[model samples]
Target: MPVCFNPLDLLMKNITPRSQIKRGENHSTRDVLLRLFLLLGIFFLLFPLRTVVAAESSGSDQQLIRMSEILRNKEKALQEKELLLREKEKRLAVLQQELQQKEKDIELLRQRAEKVLAEFQALKDEDLSRLVAVFSAMKPVAAAPLLEKLDLPYAVEVILRMQPRKAAKLLSAVNAERAAAISRSITSAKAAVE
Candidate 1:
């Protein structure tokens, strides 16, 4: 076999352990410098992004607070409306009760008025009956002359209440027009009764 001499292998064999250690220390110092620069670049790139994200989060929080306030105001308004509705209902109930009481009072007044009217009518009837009796006891000639001086309606009422024969006698003594009016009034009064 022929011997082939290699220069790289011979140099490696001649290198000292102290020189290898010095080379390794230099490579370690470069690695530390590279790692420091990479960390500074990452911090610079991410800082603005972090600031923008924080600003957006603050804006969202303000919007959420405003929405909450609006909801609270709406709830307060609804509660006020409910209270107003209840008050109106109470007022309506009171008004209805007052109206019912007024109706009852009106009915009572009407009943009292009817009773008073009936009592007044009874007194008028009694007075008319007594007047008729007084005129009937008198002589027809005397009664007729007195009746002629009275108002037509009063004379007619007195004549109509007398006995038929006495009424006829008294009427015959009066003027023809007066007797006719009395007869007509009596006929109408009888018709009203029927």
Candidate 2:
């Protein structure tokens, strides 16, 4: 609540703080001009230094960003190459499986052919001879298809081994022109052999 101030008329005390100076009594036009000149000189000296530091920092940061982008692109290219290799490996596996399956199928076909050939081999020799005899005795045109299924030389031997008259009668039952040709061949073969 107490406020006291000393003016020029106060007891002649010379104690003074520069911050507490009375502006109207102590400041002059020459002092203000000197302070302003000092402030302008300090600002001009520092400005160019600040601008140089800012430019150098910005340039370094741009170089760092370009290096990072190149690294990212390199990583992406490696991933794409690995993907292509994996696809080729998968396709090779499929081809190998198909080749193995084809080999298995071929083995099955060979086994089936062997089984059918064995059944034909099991017929008795005397039974085959009896059948040939019956065909010769009956002298039926139906016998031609069965005889033709046999090897040519074996069929001719079977016919010649039978009675000549019976074998000729069987040939006579076939189509006239075809029978005549077969009869002539058989007679000539028999004569030449004898």
Candidate 1 regions exceeding 4 Å error are: 1-46, 145-160, 175-194
> What is the Å distance of residue 181 in model 2 from its true position?
7.4
Q: Would you list the clashing residue pairs of candidate 2?
A: none
- Each model's lDDT comes to 0.80, 0.68
Candidate 2, residue 135: CA error in Å? 1.6
Best by TM-score: 1
TM of each candidate vs. truth: 0.64, 0.45
Instruction: Give the C-alpha lDDT of model 1.
Output: 0.80
lDDT of 1 by residue, 38-124 (tens): 556667757886888888998998899999999999999999999999999999999999999999999999999999999988987
| Candidate 1 weakest ten by summed lDDT | 8-17
